[model samples]
Target: MNTVIVQPTGITPADVLAVSRGGARVEISDAAMEAMRTSRALVDDIERAGRPVYGVSTGFGALANTSIAPERRAELQHALIRSHAAGIGAPMPAEVVRAMILLRVRSLALGRSGVRPDVARALVDLLNAGITPWVPEHGSLGASGDLAPLAHCALVAMGEGWVLGKDGARVGAAEALHAAGLRPIELAAKEGLALINGTDGMLGMLLLALNDLCHLLTMADLTAALAIEAMLGTDRPFQPELHAIRPHPGQGVSAANIHRLLQDSQIMDSHRNDLVHAVQDAYSMRCAPQVAGAARDTVAFATEVAARELVSIVDNPVVLPDGRVESTGNFHGAPLGFACDFLAIAAAEVGAISERRVDRLLDVCRSRDLPPFLTPDAGVNSGLMIAQYTAAGIVAENRRLASPASVDSLPTSGMQEDHVSMGWAAARKLRTVLDNLTSLLAVELLASVRGLQLRAPLTPSPAGRVAVSMVEPFAGAPGPDVFLAPVLEKTRGLVAGPDLRAAVEAEVGPLR
Candidate 1:
């Protein structure tokens, strides 16, 4: 019911997240509308004065030099939309389509794309009415601004594509718009190009991934702390002063968060002066701050990159207010693509370490007296041995999926779109990695919770206790011969819940 107005300079990840989560509405400012109007007027003047514009007066891609007659320009725009709607593969989920709509509207709202105000309004109306266009998951080379996928989005505005309605009904875009009392947007001059040419689709995936990764990173911290407590590992590895000397922002933040999570913990200090003679734990347990911190740093960088792109007008052949049209390459997705790959690598490592921790929890020798698979009847039940296998499978899958997509490219549009970034592939793979990592964390959480329960009356660190209490309601205490899949799924829901992160933060305070 609340609306958040985003000015050109005031967009934040929190604002975007709020909008994406359906808690807030997005509205553009009057200055932004004025800019769009000025740009549109320039486009009209150019078309009337018979000037040669790359996308306005000519065909797109390899046919950029071919001129369109004045009378058929509108037809040209319409044809562009209809012909380019060639998206393939499974349809993108509704949340992603909603994010794409929000991001694209924000970009055009910056007013440099030469799109008509009505076109921008149509996109906003669709968002307000919950009309999500059926955008497919494939068919983008990632060089020309996610062309095919975005065209599918533009088709809905023209009343030709499919839309998912409020009550979960599938209907034609025209009927959906008519039902909502909205009219189809008309393309004027550069409006078609503006609508279809941008990094919004790829960026939408990245934004959603970033939101999930933020939660995952915090979950990783909590899981790592639980694993450390289970292993009775020394807390010296996360000492704040030790991290301050090296001074990597992410490492320091990670160390502080882990230390906070383990602070005032009778369990963590229980093994501090014990006769336990182990020199040090494995890298997965001892170097958790370093590994998790690196991922956190990458996420920080990727967040900045995505935020910078949110307000950028990325369409080509931009129309200036002085009636000048200049051809450019703002449609390239390389920047966001590189960030997406980086995020995948980072998130993949989180899964890798989590799988290792799951292994540690399963091994009786490493789990500090916890029963094998934390089950009393391990021989008959086989306990959580298979859960570790599932975690390892997902971790290996993440490694394959995290292979940098930006490194591969293929020519399209007869070499006019040569040297593509494959950004959509990178974004898609990042989402996959996020899912895989979430599952991995869920397994780790289930194992850690089981291990913590074995240490029952030995109260965990204050932070770990809070985390355990949060998931305990959903997962319950693991018993012998129980089906682990339901428990794992419930653990995942807890990890994905908004309150989990808030609970962890409340217990541990700001993560430095």
Candidate 2:
């Protein structure tokens, strides 16, 4: 009988992830309920007063000034859902759809959207009952607030669109609603526009990508720690005083995390014998914290922007308590659009440095006495030679995707809706960058574990040993190089899962 309630003020990136992962039940607050009531009352008063209102008593887009007859109001609302539900692309992954539903619910529960309480309750009911609508992944220009993608979702409330059932099969939305003992919510004043016009599509993707990036940054820190140990690099660059002077939050956090991970490593100490034989290590080994820290800082900035966007209502022709229907640009996606692009660049940088470590690990001359390509018989067995090639390719692709999506804008809706934000493109690229970084870090993990094996009997630090143990079970030592593709895939899975991340954090403190 334990329930976790999320108020507008209390929701975080972690909370979004928990709800998307089906880890908790969600409810709107009583205060939120009252706010929704007040808002809806104002909308009714406006309609009763016989005033012009956008999207309520009138048509949408280029037809915004065109008024509808009183008798056809219901028809107008229904047509909004049908015509705007023109999303044309592959189906969005179930997780992203769930996130969109949850985000839309949270925004409405803030009580500024003028939607009826029944509409809010229906969204919350869908989240609790796990009836996610089948939303297409594309067709949003990110202005007019992701209309197409969200309309496809809003169709479910009208007892239309596809629904994913508990058994993993698609069914009619009406059937799912009936099975859950619910009915199609009647569209009240401004309800249709409130349901479909918001930045939920881009916001949902950003929420998911941000949550993953937070964890991936921690994983990157751990991977960099292992790479540092393997390369026998100096830790003085991460000294607290050095980072304190400049004091970028992410840099300080990364430096501190790396220092703690390498705290007890004897191998990290200045070695006279190794120093005489070797000069300085490569930039990948030496500047791990600085590069990784910048990416972490960018993510922190984006998280702040996204968190604010989530709680605030982004609907248009918003109803005020004073009975004024004010049309504003709050629905613009520029803020979220820019934040997602910035995060994409940040995540791509993490992949860039991790790929360098993979390269260094493969080069026999650079690797300081490890066998060529980490294969004892370099000529016969290719070992991890091709693995670096894969990592390099991924990193190169990440660079291309890192270009800012917000910088590009196009006119839409016959020049009436000019200057689109392209927020969806930014969110999409951020997700891609995250996937590439995961594979890149996995390659680094594999190479570091192999490097440690080659330098065996020379024990790694406690934290490194824990990281190695988490991945080692999934990937055993490569002997004579049979197919390594599976090993690499397993390593990627190990690093990406929450369990292995938890294990690493247990050994080394939180990599915040």
Candidate 3:
């Protein structure tokens, strides 16, 4: 992949994926360098004049009022990072660490954090050299700027903590830097504070989740289309004029996608005149667009927030261009916390509705004459009945995970840092919810595709046929149950991937 040249203003979620997961190189823009230089000069003047700045000459949090001597100032910065690097629990994935690093660099590059140009350059060098800092999952209260987690990242910059080497093994920061021909940065006034004070961790996870959901939502629409065709459900409810009356942009988009996917379907045409068929399908089959479209809308809202955060300068004491150093609360993770929780709720609903569809596909009575559990021999084989159970269990878990972490606050730093934003917790739970959602969608795809095969002779829409073909290699033809778990697992990969969507899009233009 080509390098992602990050300017202060144009870093998209796509750019984040490139650097975090695709091994893309990074270069700081010249304009950003100039901004950093200007901020550094202001910090220099503040330090020389012996003015007690909150994070520069003075201490932090509860210690903000306590001034430090000139000689001990740099030591204060070093100690701040070391003490705060007390994060516990398993380390975050390397991709998350890379995103955190990239976001931190972006925030510092905006030139309001008052860090020297060398500090930003060192961070970029670490990313370009593929050295990922070992940051634990815990220790971020999501307020006072993800202090513990980002501190772990800052520790590696000073050659103190550990890093994942190029071979993906852990190594001391000093050894990794040496091998990469990199040097550690010495501490300067407000530099350490700048490094560890931001909402990067929570925002990074949110960005990643947002990107994943963009694909997942479309897949949901495709899978919904497959379910509707398999169960002989009508697509009239998804018509544009019907959707326009209640006009949620996401709803309209989702309904259109389902309508387009089911266009020219022979299965619906074959059963178009069946007198015994019900007037409307169940909510799970009929209201797929409404539920999934709401999620699409939520993802769009979260994307806007993530975009603003990408260019935002988040630090405790911000340095303005007019040479004023002031303490501010821009580091609070409440916005990200709310967004993550909201997405989790939206994702959970999508999964819940999908599981309902899965349930309908397996129940013979509800499925309208399909085989019980989709097995050839109903009594001899259990079939994919348990798959519905698994989806149900995951959907239940998502409900609990969707509880807002932002609503819960605990005091820290001896009450000086009270009312923390558990945004990191919210972000973490959001990841789990999205993961479960992928698996949930996978189970639905498996059931729907199997149900589609039983209705063979009566073919699906062009788009639904494309979806079926994409998963056939993993899902296989319907038969008496044989080691069903592996098939479902493999189908999950297809549902959670781009190939299925790519195939459908290739034939039907594109889905919303």
Output the number of the TM-score-best candidate: 3
Highest lDDT, which number? 3
List the candidate 2 regions with Cα displacement exceeding 4 Å. 1-10, 165-169, 269-274, 277-279
Clashes of 3: 0
- For model 3, what is the error of residue 232's alpha carbon versus the real structure, in angstroms, after optimal superposition? 1.0
- Residue-by-residue lDDT tens digits, candidate 3, 352-404: 99999999999999887789998878988878899999999999999999999
- In angstroms, how far off is 100's CA in candidate 1? 1.6
Q: Tell me how far the alpha carbon of residue 106 in candidate 2 is from the true structure, in angstroms, after superposition.
A: 2.2
Instruction: Rank all candidate structures by their TM-score, best first, as comma-separated numbers.
Output: 3, 1, 2
- The TM-score between candidate 2 and the true structure equals 0.95
Instruction: Sort every candidate by lDDT, greatest first.
Output: 3, 1, 2
Task: Give me the displacement of residue 97 in model 3, in angstroms.
Answer: 1.0
lDDT of 1 by residue, 242-354 (tens): 99888778888778777777777777767777757335778998788898889889988998898788766687877666667887788799999999999999999988998
Model 2 residue 493 lDDT?
88
Clashing pairs counted in every model: 0, 0, 0
